[model samples]
Target: MAVASNYLLDTGPLSILCSFPLNASPYIYAILQYTKITLADSVIIEAGRGKIWRIVSPLFKTGEIESTTTPKEPEILDLSYGNDLGLGERSTIKSAMQMGLTAIIDDRDAFVVANRFAVHPIGFQDWMVMLSREVNLPTKMAIEIVRSSANQFPKMFLAHILKLLSE
Candidate 1:
């Protein structure tokens, strides 16, 4: 089996996935095939009792979604003062910084903040494409999934991603 790549998931990416059809199992499963997704405690709290939580709850129980606590380290304190980021985003970025993991953050502001901190961030759209190309998920299905969540992404950004997928 191929070793899975680990990624820190911020609430933005989870929210985007939550916007998918009732049960996001298929897509989630596809991702889990080659990626280990970790969610910080703050991310769970931020998700709350919503569609996102509902979908992730089972995964958490099944160990498909790993849970982690945000360290009270200096990195978190630095993030706290850097931007108007939410608890989840800050925790995710800080965790990524300490762990040397890439973060999946779809929000533009959070993405920028992560970059500024030298925590490499992947947008959800780009992540989808990466899974398709690197993990050998069907390209058509990947594009379909991206289109399904089109409304959640910015128009220009979505268009650009679509063009990349086409190429």
Candidate 2:
């Protein structure tokens, strides 16, 4: 059997995945069940004593989740200079490129950087659409999850999601 494509998440996507209200956003859970979800150790450090880890720790404990570290890629970070962003975004993008995995990043600068490196970058709204389509999540429930998490999403992205939900 063919393995599914792996998705490497940054702090933003990981936080959103773990932030859904209890009992809602089952699509998030379903996606986790179906995909090889990974997080860079830098992202975990950035999440830092938050609810994201609390809700997802059981999965990690059960070996359903995986974490990795990118060491240091000075060349990649050097290319990202003058962007005025931190190393976390740089590292996330670099790690994804190095591993040839899709990356989930919500920050605009980070998204741009990832795109520049030719690494596919997706945001929360993209996840909503993807999860809905790939896992057969009900459109209504996916919309609700996107709407409820709108505040955590970029405005442009939220608008696009609303449009998709409306259609």
Candidate 3:
């Protein structure tokens, strides 16, 4: 489906955001301040693992993220039939479809399937670009954040995106 401007949070992106500046970046939460953001309890559960709850709670308290109820069983079942995905990813996709919001997921498998459901999927690098553009962040800073992230994605992947941004 076409990617809408608004978004729903998934575990991966949200987890990384929690490590960013706000103690919970959800960068879109900060970048798309004027846009509504949706989150399901499932994503919360996944994100809350470890010390993430400590960092993520305030964003909810301050109204940076809007919580969504669980998806109806039939809808969730229908989504599950074709793919094996986590509850958080499924819930994010369901919420995205129901709300017409983009699914802010970072997993390639889930992201590809989300598109088949006609919901747009946004990735971490996409937000990195958004922050870079919105704040006119120096290329160096963007590169630093990606390289320094605790996620430790991969050297080649980072190199590709950094090179793309440079070009």
lDDT of each model, Cα atoms only?
0.79, 0.72, 0.67
**For all candidates, what are the clash counts?**
0, 0, 3
In candidate 2, residue 141 scores what lDDT?
72
**On residues 13-116, what C-alpha lDDT tens digit does candidate 1 reach at each position?**
88766666524454666667677889989999999997788788999899888988887775644546545778898889878887888899977778887887
Worst 10 residues of 2 by lDDT: 22-31
TM-score, candidate number 1: 0.86
Candidate 2 Cα deviation (angstroms), residue 134? 2.5
- After aligning candidate 2 to the native by TM-score, how far in Å is the CA of 140 from where it should be? 2.8
Q: Candidate 3 lDDT, tens digit per residue, 24-128? A: 343444444434556888888867556567766776798866788866744744545436788788778777777776677887778887887788787777656
Model 2, 112: alpha-carbon shift in Å? 0.9
Q: Identify the leading candidate in terms of TM-score.
A: 1
Please list the residue runs of candidate 2 whose C-alpha ends up more than 4 Å from where it truly belongs after superposition: 1-4, 22-30, 78-83, 165-167
TM-score of 2: 0.81
Off by over 4 Å in 1: 1-3, 22-26, 75-83
